[model samples]
Target: MIKSIGQLFFLALSCLAIAILQFSFISSFPGAFNQINIGLIAMVFILFFFGIKSAILFIFFFGSFMDIFSFQFFSFHLLVLATVSLVVYLILENWLTNKSLYSFWVLCLIASVTYGFISSILLFVFSGLGGGFSIFSLYFWQSLLYQSLWLLLVASLFFNIFVSLAKRFKPFFLEKKGVI
Candidate 1:
């Protein structure tokens, strides 16, 4: 039980770290490109290895953290994060193969894109009341494109680090392979 709590605490800390970056650093990218959302990417990282409970905690805290920084958005981010996290977890947890560089690449790309669209959609609905948002605006496309680049670059660089850490702890969800 203590081991599990330790893991959860580390996971939460990681989520908070990414949330801080996503809020202050990534959003300062000087254009719509910042919408790639490193926080959500880190949340995806949580989903990749952690079980449903940890992923859910990470998502809730992540969205809440973002909300704290955001103005007038209330729980919109939280709702979207939870929904997307669940869907992503369901698909990836079942279909994903054991750790591989290729899976990391594809999963990162997919998670980034999924986050982009889901958050955009949520924003669109909320902003539609004020008639100020456009789902197809050029900014949307630019963000999606640029964010994918960021996702690929970051995931490539960090893939080994996450894998190595997972190897050390062997989190609850990762299946233990048999030794020959």
Candidate 2:
């Protein structure tokens, strides 16, 4: 129990740091670079490796941190993240049973697309209803495209490196001896 708590604590800190870096540093980049959505990528990674329980906690911290920095209404970031997480979790639990790099990649792709679309839809709706800005423009689509590409690239690189080092993710194979 203590070990689990420690792990959760560590995850929270790391997630918080990721949120800060995402808003403070990554968001400052020009054009498509700023649309990378490292926070969403990190959340997908957590969901893939740490299971839904840890991922729920991660979403809470990371989403809350992001909401703090966002210009939209409170909890907007959290809502988008939670929605994406739920969709990924359902897909992972129901369809994708294999816990391999391929599945992780698929989840990352799904999460990225889902996050972009959901956030855009919400922004559009909110702007229609009240004070938010419109998102139905070329920049939105371009950002989504760039975000998906960046997510897949980063996820593939990280998954490969981590899989190489983590024995748990390595595939098991049987060696055949002489005819028995």
Candidate 1 lDDT for residue 147: 82
Model 1: which residue pairs collide? none
TM-score of 2: 0.89
Residue 168 displacement (Å), model 2? 0.8
Q: What is the C-alpha lDDT of each candidate?
A: 0.73, 0.85
Over 4 Å off, model 1:
1-14, 165-180
Candidate 2 residues 82-180, lDDT tens each?
999999999999999798878987898899889988887887777776744435577777887899899999999888887888767888878788855
Q: What is the TM-score of each candidate against the true structure?
A: 0.77, 0.89
Worst ten in a row by lDDT for model 2: 128-137
User: Which sections of candidate 2 miss by over 4 Å?
Assistant: 1-5, 130-136
